[model samples]
Target: MMGGPSENPELWAFLESLHCGEFLSGTVTAIERFGVFVALDDGPDHPVFPGVGFISFAELSWQRFEAASDVVQVGQRVSCEFLQFDTWNLEARLSLRATQPDPFQVFADGAAVGQKLHGRVTKLAPFGAFVQVVDGIEGLVHLRELAWTPVETPSDAVQVGDEVTVVVTEIDRERRRLALSRRKGSSEHR
Candidate 1:
């Protein structure tokens, strides 16, 4: 059974009536260029679901994800927020992004420029390692920012799951971006 319906017909009926807000524990049936397909356990039948749910790409996560396959696989189960449902089309919009706090927001609202944060390496790119400040939120530790010495690639200094301290050098909220350095400071050195 889906998370929305726990065998209580009354609760299900009530939930079905007002189809806005978050929905949790949905099943992922497909991953496509347009979006991820999730069959809502609590979603209403055709003609009523259209206006109630929506999933925007921006609201999908706090991390930098290029492809859905990296985090979500076909038939894999995931928790998502029901943003809107198109009842006319019998379609729903869901977002994994809505399920967590934006990392950029956390850095912007609290961590001052140059404040140090401990993060775990989640992914390594040619330029840097993606570090998680918290679940679903990540900032990039660029290769140039890994240490005082030159690093050809990010993997030299840290491997996935390695925990390291990083300083917040810059934040671009509009872009949903963060720049971090591993070097220690009063200077917040790179």
Candidate 2:
């Protein structure tokens, strides 16, 4: 929420301005060996940068993979809950996976199906990709939903530990089947 001089006249009068950490959604602009870059959805030109957050290999997901490329692609949108704003860098630190939601609490709450969620790509497999749904709960994205075409190989579309936006397609409590999909016609996703 960018407040202009007219909206908040006080901002113009003040020589310096103040900013706070707000949970701003974003899209993954780039991915690298170290970390991923996310362009702020609501910001000045959506500056793309690394250090928004880091998903270590161990914390990636439940499935095992050979490399990160198996989980994410070059163009994809990812939603993250802002952790804080770095004053020096003017960047926001975010969490791709839902870490704040305690596992026990979520179990007690009994989250319903079709609940849209934000997640990060941790690993990829031939059948589908694995994502950290919550702190403890991990979900899968079948190859079909990952892209429009038949993904011969998941690595071609995604890499490990990539940030992505997904919606709950199905929830099976007995078998623990959590299916998710990317929103249709995303700008960041090519």
Candidate 3:
């Protein structure tokens, strides 16, 4: 359980045979600030890790959390979609969120262009601001859509944590993108 592949032939074989997109069951073995380690139920001891499976922060859940532990606790059973065999880390890259329904899909189903919504600015970039329209749902307010006047940066119009009202301009369901605008006429209302 603590050594390399030679120490666990069964695990070595199982790890080697795993492919991307395969769904596997595992128990949360350890929780770290960066990610969660899973002891795969169907696999053997990892050569270096406490578990054979690992899920990064982004793959833990669709809903954003302050920490990984907020989403998964040690000893919890989880089914994950195998993203890839992380050769560099010698661990299986897994995504727990993939097995769950996407919140964006649900938001898109009920949202329409020209719908006005109030949301808080979650992040700011030079090009735009990402507004959290709903739990686990964010839409981009492009710099050009930030205001009617020409804007040099997103911060010129909005800052992180600012609650602002915006109109939905475009929703690309396939791409899971929502384009929003603060300026009235800037929105692509259909």
CA lDDT for candidate 1: 0.67
Residues 1-190, candidate 3: write the lDDT tens digits. 2456666667656778998888999899999877899998878777677788999998998887898878989999999999987655668899999999899998988999999999999999888999999988999999988987879988888889998899999999898899998886334443
RMSD of each: 8.8, 16.6, 3.9
Task: Show the lowest summed lDDT stretch of 10 residues, model 3.
Answer: 181-190
- Compute the lDDT of residue 76 as modeled in candidate 2: 62
TM-score of each: 0.53, 0.41, 0.77
Q: Candidate order by TM-score, highest to lowest? A: 3, 1, 2
- Where does candidate 2 stray beyond 4 Å? 1-110, 183-190
Q: Tell me the whole-model lDDT of each prediction, alpha carbons only.
A: 0.67, 0.58, 0.87
The best candidate in terms of lDDT: 3
1 or 3, greater by lDDT = 3
- Superior candidate under TM-score, 1 versus 2: 1
> In model 2, where is the ten-residue run with the lowest total lDDT?
11-20
**Number of backbone collisions per candidate:** 17, 9, 0
